[model samples]
Target: MLLLNGDEVRKAFPVTEAYRVVAEVMRRYSAGDVVQPVRTVLGPGCDGSLFAAMPCHVTGESDSGYGLKAVLHAPGNTNRDLPTHVGVVVVFDPETGQPLAMMEGAAVTALRTAAASAVATDALALPDAGDLALIGAGTQARSHLLALREIRRLRRVRLWNRGNARAKEFLQWARTHTDIDIERMNSPAEALCGADLVCTTVDTTEPLVSAKDLAEGAHVNAVGSSVPGKRELSADAVASCSAFVDSREGAQRESSELAAPIEQGLLPADRPLPEIGEVLLGRHPGRSGTSERTLYKSLGMAAQDVASGFAIVQSAQRLGIGTMTDFTG
Candidate 1:
């Protein structure tokens, strides 16, 4: 089996290539060409960490395979200066069911999640949307900045993070990766006001963004809250926009961003929350007009990780990256 570390995974699947791979995966998933069950999340131990098992299989694709990503989400890791998400993704041959490769899951999640957002933003945001408002300064924030820049010409970035030290660290990190001017904001409202594109990547249960602050033509990628009970956007904020999701089933089961709005009757219970895939497939008109607000609720899926991992394994094979070993010595 091939073993890939975080750096190797990142090198094998850059954000640009990740965008294309994830987009195709989403399309196949929405078209019922992929088989993925809803992920099982077990959690909130004494330390408030959670573990999840996400698995999927893709059919009718050149890189069809079975993949399982077992991950631990430990928010407290920030205090320890470690990543909050850490785990491994294992890939199995579709035809023979033999384990083929194992790779770092955090890298895969970071790459594919941001790439999925970029896909949604491209399909739902206005053609020229550029100004960005980022709600958190974590790893996901950094990845989103890089991925979004590939699709849109960013004019500036407004950032808000709970910790000033972390925000400063992120600013320094940004200087090396991007030339775009980023302003530090004291509050979420300050960062979000009139921004054309907004991303919320913080780990929070309470709302940080409000509908009152969003511009008419704004597009939001709500990335932080994936589970049912946690949320980052106000109910009104979600209700005010035309919402899209990575998967309708996943969103209905796991998205806190949509749950409150749906329960409060702000977003009609029967409202159609189209998948980003549907938008990509041209089955749904993502943004009705320039004046309409659009929101993409992302609940990361197993199919994405599987398809992405399959692609990464293929690329590493051709490029001679990663360590290859066999257990049957």
Candidate 2:
């Protein structure tokens, strides 16, 4: 079995390569070439944390694998200077169910999630879209910045975070990494207003981005709230936009971004939430009008992590990156 730590996994899976792998798997997922169960969660137990298990099987002609990602989400870990999510993704053989590899899950989660957004942005956003607004300066914000820069030529970046110190820390980090201009915004509205592209990665139960504040033809990646009853976009914002999702069933099951508005009649009950894979596959027209508002509500999927982990394992094998051990010996 191959054992990969976070650093090894990150080294094996480059951000640019992740975009292609994630998009291919998503297309396979939407085309019924993959089997993935909706992630199951247990407890805000005594530690006020939740444990989630996501399992997936990909049966594509070229990429056949079975994988499971188990993670613990502890929101309070931020105070401890630790990652809020910690887990492992185990890749198994499709034919024999033998363990193939075990890798750090958080890195896979972050990279693939950002890659999914990049896929959505590439397929749905206007070709010339450049300016960006990032509402949340967490690890995702940094990852998205790296991922999106690959797909688009960003002219400027507007950043906002709930905490001033973290926002400042992000700015300092950004200055050292990329030469692009990044400005700190006083509020989410200030950050999002008139931006060609927007990403909301903050964990908020209430709405942060509204339709009124967004520019014409703006593309928003609503990435933060994955669980039911937690959303970052206003109901009106969701209603006003042509929504796309990574998975229709996952979105319907876990996202109030889609459910709340439809329930409130702000959005039509019969409206179609096209999968981003459909857009990538050319089965669905992504953005119809130049001025049409677009939203990609990303509910992170097990297939993405499975495919990413598989690809990373392949890369590591080729590069001799991770430690390989035989447990059955």
Candidate 3:
């Protein structure tokens, strides 16, 4: 088995390359070429964080492979000055059923999650989008910024967080690290108003972006809520937008952004819903016009984990980066 640490994985899979790989994976998914089951969640309590397990198998295009990803979401870890997400991925050869690699899961998750958003944005967002809005200042928010930068020519970014200190810190970091103009907003409305692209990365039950604040040509990526009761987009926001999802089965049960509106009758049950894979496959149309509002809700997938794991493994081998060991018994 090849063992890959976080640093090694980072060196092997750059964000740009990860985005490309994820895009192709989504295209395959859209065309019904991959097998990805909805994630299974194991939670302890209402306040207790949950653990998720996702598994997938991909064969035909490359060496047949299967992978399992485990994620722990302990929000309270923030108080301990630790990351809220931690995980790992284990890959096995399809021909032998032998474990092939063990990889750092946190980095893989961040890259694939952001790359998934980029894929959706590439397919759904308007080509001329310039202004961007980000809700939350966590790792996912940072990843979103990096991923979108690769897909669009953003000129300005507006950031809003529940805490002013966090928002200011992120704004300062953006100014120091990126050339784009960064503004710290006092409210979600201020951050969203007139923005062409909006990314919601918070894990809150309340709606962050109001429907009235969203521009007509806006494209929103709601990445915060992957659980049943956690929602960040308002019913009005969801109802008024033409929405797409990474997976319909995942979104219907796991997406709080879609569930809120769905429960309120704002989102129609009969409306034609298309997966991101279908969009990538050209079976479903993306954004119709610049005036149309589009929303992409992602509930992170196992296929993404498997795809990214495979990429990291291939890149590591090419770069001669990891230690190979035997895990067959």
Candidate 4:
């Protein structure tokens, strides 16, 4: 077995490159070329923690193959000065089911998750889009800042968070790392106004974004709220947009971004919520008009982890990075 740590994973698969990788996976996914089961989430431990596993495989592609990601979400880790997302991704040979490599999952998850949003934004957002609104100041917000830059020439970034201290720290970090002008906002509405690309990365059950506040021709990447009962967008906000998902099945089962609205009779079940992959594969048109608001529901698919794992392993092999263990012995 091979081991690639967080540093290795980031070096091998940066967020900028991960966008291209995720886009390819999405394309294959829409064409019925991959096999991925619904992610199973268990827990609300005594401490309100979560454990989940995602498994996926490609059918014929020799490049992007098979893998599984085991993830743990510990909300209390913040107090312990550790990353909230703790996990590992295991790659396997599609033909033989042989263990190939294991890499740190946190870096992979952050990078690929944002990269997928960049892909969706690139496909769905207006070509001249520049402003970006990120509705969280956590890890995903930082990743999205880096990933979105590759897809759009961001002129300004609007950041909003419930904690001003966290927002201040996040802004300072972004200012030091990137040249984009970041404005720390006190309210979600203030952060959302006039932003062409919005990414809701907060963990919340209540809606933060409303349909009335959406900018004309804006595209939103609702990347947070992985649980079925949590929603970041208002039901009206979701119903008004041309909605897309990473996986329709995954969204229907794991995320309430779509399910909640449908269950409430807000969005028509027959309204054709095509997966983002369908647009990438040219099977469906994305963004019907310039003024249409588009929303991408990213539940973070297992296939994303599998594709990224394969990519990093391949890159690591060429770069002569990672530690190898003789599992055969």
Regarding TM-score, does 1 or 3 come out ahead? 1
The sequence of per-residue lDDT tens digits that candidate 4 reaches over residues 39-87 is 8889965987899998888755545677899999898998998988899
How do the predictions measure up, each by TM-score?
0.97, 0.97, 0.94, 0.96
Residue-level lDDT of model 1, residues 1-329, one tens digit each, is 89999999999999888999999988898898988889999985688889999888887556577889999988888789898888999999777778889999999989999999999999999999999999999889999999999999998899999998889999999988788778999999999988999999987899998899999999999998888788999999999999999989999888878988888888678899899998889898779999999999998989888888899999999889999888456
RMSD list, candidates in order: 1.2, 1.3, 1.7, 1.5
Model 1 root-mean-square deviation: 1.2
| Worst ten in a row by lDDT for model 3 | 56-65
Off-target runs (Cα >4 Å) in candidate 2 are: 45-47
lDDT per residue (tens digit) for residues 28-118 in model 3: 7766777888888899898788999888886557633788998898889989988888889988876788888889898888888999999
lDDT (10s digit) by residue, model 2, range 1-329: 99999999999999989998999998998899888988998985588688989988888755468889999988898899999989999998767778989999999999999999999999989999999999999989999999999999999899999998999899999999988779999998999888989999987898888878899999999898888768899888888889999999898888988887888878778899899999888899899998998999998999999899889988999999888888679
Q: Candidate 3 — which pairs collide?
A: 1-325, 30-277, 30-278
Candidate order by TM-score, highest to lowest? 1, 2, 4, 3
Winner by TM-score between candidate 4 and candidate 3: 4
